[model samples]
Target: MRFLLFILICAGLILTAESCKKECHDRSNPDCENYDPCYGKQPLTADFETFEVSIFPDNWIPYSTDTLASSDVFFRAKEENVEYEWTVGSETITTRSFTRKNFPVGVRIPITLKVKRKTDFGCFPTDSVVAQTRNIFVIDGYENSKVAGYYQGYHTNNAADTFTVCIYIPEYSMNPPHEKTTISGLMNISTCADNKINVSGSESVGYKQYTFLSQDGFCHGAWGRVRVDSAFMGHIRIDYSYLKDLTDIKSQVDKTFLGKRIN
Candidate 1:
């Protein structure tokens, strides 16, 4: 009878041990393939909330958003519990659009976006992104002047040979200068008729100067000259001036009884 009681006690102990083992396994195993319970809980991403800024008319400045869209600036989420902050280097940014107000022509403006995210465990993750727009206000080869016109001129010696020049000014800049302004553009001396000049070059406007050379033969003549008036209202009056020769003029009038020619 004692042996029988011992055997039953042993069986009960074995069953209890097996049940405890099964419970431990069930509690520890994760549902997903990796079986890491803390995987999603940890913060894993850091990124910019926006990648680009939009400018609007009347000095409207628009900022980027975190949503996913073709137009929306996209940033990869680094980790969970993220926070975003934006900064514009220049105050000239007016309105919802990134209108660089009072921004100097040929200046490069850098805009920054900062992102902060935290994990479920209270750890913070931070990251930042930057976008740069160079000479955004001034178009290439176009400088501070606000004048636009077609000017033609030639070297003083040649009347038949001619050259054409174009000047472009920014739409902004109240009271833009009319004189003492050097307008630069590309010129094809060989192919004047084609006139395939690039107003804007590889560099942004205000960053570099552009120059066009007149044909070699035209350089020696009274080619051309154009001058802008003194007014500061973006109005440029272009005048084409050429050289003239007088062949029938006499140097001296009748010198009485002298060897001088008569007028």
Candidate 2:
């Protein structure tokens, strides 16, 4: 009876050892209590948020000598207690939160956030995570300026015909002796070069006013208004009158244009 009892006890010990071996070896199984399911996986989480602020406000006038033209992007990490490294373009920053001043405009930017934490798992040693944020576009301050971009729209008289216009205003100064602004367009409007334009408006009106005349010995004059909406959509309206070279008579144009900012 004693020998039989010893044989049974040895069989029970072997069965218990086999069960434990099966459970522990299946480390990926969630039901296995003795083994970690997250073994060999990245154990750290990394995430971040970004906010952009335009350096120039609605009433801001851009001067040629004015230095600040780019926007600012603020970055913040959602997690704490881990080492942080931020990669922006060719530069790198090591901080929990930071503000990037004078960020470039009119292009998509990819910002990367990397974090690492000390781990108890010797095989892994350190838990590392990488997160990426992209499609960051900083609006150019010059976008808000009048006579700065290509515009397209239709006149009320002829909706079927598209009128495209381009305006170029040299970087402006609030003080006098400003550089010349120019306008060129299709559909009855001739290129008016060397326009001596003075832009004036109040904040309550929410638009820049440009009353200009051609200095190139032609009777080209206009009262124009330009507004940049919140979505960066540019709007322009010109009441133009010029002496036609063919008829030697004055012609007029009253139209509004909508366009996107290229700069």
The model with the greatest TM-score is 2
Off by over 4 Å in 1: 1-29, 37-81, 90-105, 122-263
Candidate 2 residue-wise lDDT, 85-141, digit = tens: 888889899898887886676667777888877764755645555565545655454
By TM-score, how accurate is candidate 2?
0.33
The number of the candidate with the highest lDDT is 2
Candidate 2, residue 57: Cα displacement in angstroms equals: 12
C-alpha RMSD values across all candidates: 23.7, 15.5
Report the C-alpha displacement of residue 257, candidate 2, in angstroms.
28
lDDT of 2 at 41: 62
Q: lDDT of each prediction vs. the true structure?
A: 0.33, 0.54
Q: Report model 1's TM-score to 2 decimal places.
A: 0.23
